[model samples]
Target: MSQLRTILICDDEEELAHELGEFFEGNGWKVDVCVTGMAAIEKLRKGLAPHVLITDLRISDFDGAQVVSVARELPPEMRPLMTIIITGHVMDTARAVDFMCDYLYVKPIDPDVLLANIGEFLAHRTFPAAGRS
Candidate 1:
């Protein structure tokens, strides 16, 4: 059997985080949820390398950009294959370009659309061979 895909989701809205986690779990992904950016960072630092990361742009104790930045700093093998940022706030074009994410979705995000995008990203990405970064 194929290995299960993993995902980390960080959002200050506890309900949203839980709901997203459940949705992704139901779709066959192993999901981890955090209510703060720092918590998500801690998970990464602890070696919980996930295939994908979905974080809110504005979260408690820091922003999604910082979380993505931390994930990017991980070694190639530990880094997430895809990083996505979701926010309800309207951001300036120049400002939005600063986030280190593969995709940015404005909330309230349609979970189905996000899932489709994730599927497309994973399907198109070329992963490293086993034991390679």
Candidate 2:
């Protein structure tokens, strides 16, 4: 059997985080939710390598950009296959370009659409095994 796909969600909005976690979990993703960017970073430091990362851009502490930056700095084997930033603010092109992430989504996201996009992204990519040259 294939390994289960894992996802980490970091959003200061507790209700939104939990709701997203539940939706992804119900759809067969192993989901981890963090209500703070610090907690998300700590989890990464502790070696919680996930296939996907979804973080809110304007977290009260640390911010999503910092969280994504930390994740990007990890060893290749520890980096997430995809990093997505979600924000409530309407971002202009220049502002959106400031963050390092695979996708930048606006808040009030449609869970189904997000899931479909993720599925499409995964389908077109191959994940190499750790330590492979």
**What lDDT tens digits, residue by residue, belong to model 1 across residues 1-133?**
1667889999999999999999999998889999999999999988888889999988979989999999999988888999999998876573435796899988899999999999898997666544221
**lDDT digits (tens) for residues 61-123 of candidate 2:** 978999999999999888888899999998767353578888889989999999999888877
C-alpha lDDT of all candidate models, in order? 0.87, 0.88
> TM-scores of all models?
0.90, 0.91
Clashes in candidate 2: how many? 0
Name the 10 consecutive residues with the lowest summed lDDT in model 1.
124-133
Return the number of clashes found in candidate 1.
0
Kindly give the number of clashing pairs for every candidate.
Answer: 0, 0
For all the candidates, what are their Cα RMSDs to the real structure?
2.5, 2.8
